[model samples]
Target: MPDLLETVIENRWMVQPNHANNLDTAHGGNVMKWMDEAGAMSAMHFTGETCVTAHMDEVNFKQPIPVGDIALVKSYVYRAGEHSVRVRTRVFRENPGKTETELTTESYMIFVAIDEDRNTTSVPELTVGSERGERLREEALSDAP
Candidate 1:
């Protein structure tokens, strides 16, 4: 069994001019790519196998992260089926100097584990082994689409 909390991963990407859209904010595609990478990492870490994205739930851009801001992406495995892992990923706009952060985008991603032969493989069950893990799972469930 894999503990859900152990699958958590976080990454920070500086929103640069190259990542900006015409609005001078992070592009939606770039944000989604970051979220996907984070989510895939969580899934792969949990399953100890190569994981590829199978599906993505509807994503929402609640706020735009302007250039010079940090896009903080966090991901964790909340649930697992026989061969698929469900990951919850969220991006926040962060101002490091002021220590401020706000939600920018969120979505659930599903990934399927694969083996060296490129075949789907069974994954270990996910378990919530601590209070914090339980709380995080609950939060993801509540925010699910």
Candidate 2:
């Protein structure tokens, strides 16, 4: 079994003109789409089954991403239950000159595993096999908002 931290999934989307709002920054809707996709991947990795978004705790846009910037979206399963998986996601702006990545957005999402019949299904217990995985789970629990 892989650790939850090792199960992290990431996707990158270039900020295009169509994805931007009137201000020329990446639109909130587009960001949400990226977050949803990345978070779903993480949930699927943890559950080994298809999942649907049960709830979005909160999406905080800390900084604006420009049209030319690349949005690096990363997600990992932080906690899991019988049918629900909690995922933590972060969006970063890719900048070559910066030594540190700039966090643009973050959110906590909950997904419910589903069977082929469209009914909720049980998932395996989350194994925090590594120290990093345990740390992330603790952080997720501590930071409710």
Candidate 3:
């Protein structure tokens, strides 16, 4: 069993000029890419096998991450089926100097565990290791809108 909390991952990407759009903010594709990477990492952590995106819930872009901002991407495994793991991923626009942050994107991703032969494999069951883990799981599920 893999604890949900143990699969959590957080990553930050600086919005470089090349990654910006004509609006001088991070491109939507870039944000999605970051989210996918974070989500995939969480899935891999939970499954202990190569995980690939099987499906993704609709993404809602709430805000833009402007140039010079940090895209803070966080992901965690909330639940898992026999062969697929569901991960919640979110990106926030962060101003490190001022310590301000705002939600930019939220999405749920599903990844299927695969073996070297590209065959689907069974993933570890999601286990609740602590009270905090259970609370976080519930919070994420309820907060997802």
By lDDT: ranked, best first: 1, 3, 2
- State the lDDT of candidate 3 residue by residue for 9-33, as single tens digits: 9999999999999999999999999
* lDDT for 124 (candidate 3): 82
Candidates' RMSD to native: 0.7, 1.5, 1.2
Q: Pick the lDDT winner.
A: 1
Q: Which pairs of residues clash in candidate 2, taking residues 3 or more apart in a chain or in different chains?
A: none
Candidate 1: deviation at residue 135, Å? 0.4
- Higher-ranked by TM-score: 2 or 3: 3
Best prediction by TM-score:
1
Off by over 4 Å in 3: 143-145
Candidate 3 TM-score over all chains jointly: 0.95
Model 2 / residue 55 / CA error / Å = 0.1
Clashes of each: 0, 0, 0
lDDT of 1 by residue, 26-94 (tens): 999999999999999999999999999999999999999999999999999999999999999999999
**Per-residue lDDT over 1-145 for candidate 2, one digit per residue giving the tens place of the 0 to 100 score:** 5479765998988799999999999999999999999999999888888999999977899999998888999899888887898899899987544556789999999999999999999988788877877888888788867
Q: How close is candidate 1 to the true structure, as a TM-score?
A: 0.98
